[model samples]
Target: MSTDNKVPEIRSKGFSGEWAEEILGDVAEIKTGPFGSTLHAKAYVEDGHAIITTEHFKSGELPVDKKNIPQVSEDDYLRLKAYLLKVGDIVFSRVGSVDINALVTNKQEGWLFSGRVLRVRSGKIIDSEYLHHELSTSRVKKSVVSRAVGQTMPSINTEILKITPIHFPLDTTEQTTIGNYFQKIDALINQHQQKHDNLSNIKKAMLEKMFPKQGETIPEIRFKGFSGEWKNLTLGDLGSVAMNKRIFKHQTTISGEIPFFKIGTFGKQADAFISKNLFDEYKAKYPYPVAGDLLLSASGSIGRVVEYKGEEQYFQDSNIVWLKHDGKIDNAFLKVFYSMVKWSGLEGSTIQRLYNKNILDTEISTPERQEQTAIGNYFQKLDNLINQHQQQITKLNNIKQACLSKMFV
Candidate 1:
């Protein structure tokens, strides 16, 4: 992060060009929007000439949606023409601990900016995209924020942003290359994120349509060939609920033969461990989750469910509850059902929690065994797709972060 003359640790192939360290004001024109008093809340409309505020560009780029933005009158827009955004203007949040930014494109041109944002316009000497990314870097932010803090808000002002150091490549070609590279990376990330969100929303909608609502005997929608009313019963009727073996904090280890899980590790890796001897002793007396058993987090993050894969792991008793379902209920069907389950009639005392009795008393609707299996399998495949999309997004973000760190000074 130091502003040193040494070259970046990583760079694109065929490029080892030296970077130029220059104060931001020297390379770009800086200005802010009209003040708050000039654009009062009373003038805002639900739909009109859109105004971009600090909230609009929280992620360092302009969001596409304009109709959601608060709007001003025609007179107000003309009066604030000086503050209107033009294509290629990089916008920064003038207030906040985080340095949020955005690049104005043709789609954003002519939109009025709120008083809390600063507009930075780079000349031909600097690449607009590259400068936007540079301003977004954590290193420069750490250095500049020291001089920009305000009394009431964690903020940066025009004076400090003007002189903020911009570490940039001397080669405009390299700058463009880096800029375009990140643009593509961002596009891919957005693409995968959209797919993930769509899948999640689809599953949610399907759950509502496929499951019977309160006081109803049958769901409004069902798979083809599925007919007749679903049978209703309390959760206790479908499965024998059980709790995990009690393992006190001091009794656990940082590492051992059996992986030990607390609430935090319900669907993740075990954080602690128990010895094989201790695990076996409890296995004979206490119940442990096996294949097909559904584990539910019963603590602060209540009702988070995970089906056991029969892994060699121990679960904490106080924070976790397990469901040992009989052959009457399909494990996969129950897994999908839990995600849509809304536990009712529980009193909100301290923290919201689901007790063993609460779980037993909750109502459930079930179809025939074969129909349950088919629905469960369909949902399982959908879930796998969601996971794969999520993993791709994570992997892409990691790559992007590494590139940002290594490609910049």
Candidate 2:
């Protein structure tokens, strides 16, 4: 696993020569950021010169989002000019999350690094983007993190970073080619991420507009031919909170015939399980969620809603409850409504735990059943698109990791 090995297990076609190995110090100029005294908080201004902090490093790229970045006055920027970032410069976190690093592109050029960052500007020997991909490899990241010195809050210094070993092809063209290949993958990831974020924002907007604001009977937006003001009613008018019969600690096993979901794993994979005999008996006798029923988290991250598809799963009592409702409201409509509901206790206090009364008594303005179905169907389609984009992002990232492992020493 050492960089001393010149030939990687995988490489591009027409590239046969052994890769070169050298300590980072010999291939790049390493520098640390300014001291706290040199760059004080009071020196920052509304907007003048940007200062790159460890927060700016995300997905191995510098200044992922430039908005709201700390800025300094022109005079202060000149005083701390030595810490100025340049294109192709790579920055690393000096304290906490010491292994994370990012490459500076033209967008971040001339920006100054904050007190908690370390900078590495590459020499003529290595391609900066290629080195970024090299350092991003799991092997190099683990090495860097292991070298960082601190038990509670790991930190790295310029001296330690300088000695970090880096391996790369001798030819600059190969370096650029390899870098460019991954760059395209990263571009694709960013493109999908942008679409994901945009879709999420659109959903947010729709949620706000489609639901009635407090003190109002109608939402800002609605479906055609559904023009009348919505009905105002407490959740109790539609349903009551119901939960499964409790299964004590002894009744469950780590791995068993049926997956058991607790508050911690309400909408996720189950960590506990029950025997088939217990599941069959309890499901027959106890209050069980039917298909299309909305199973919700009543504790821990409260208000998380998941539509049950009649899966053979047992949920913990009280901690995960669902509304046993009449068919007045569509489940799809109710499911999305759960996303925006604000839980409050008696006497109008914000609740810590979602008591059954809190859920049943919460006031809501609901459209007629038909309009509810249309709104539900619309948001559901948007959610499906968002989920598809998210899945694509995850798949692309996995491919990137595989390439990073095989394409580098």
lDDT on C-alpha atoms for all candidate structures: 0.83, 0.87
Best by lDDT: 2
Tell me the tens digit of each residue's lDDT in model 2 across 237-336: 9888889999899999999889999888888899999999999998899889889999888775778898899889999998888888867789888888
Q: lDDT for model 2, on a 0 to 1 scale?
A: 0.87
lDDT of model 1, residue 346: 58
Off by over 4 Å in 1: 1-4, 150-152, 345-350
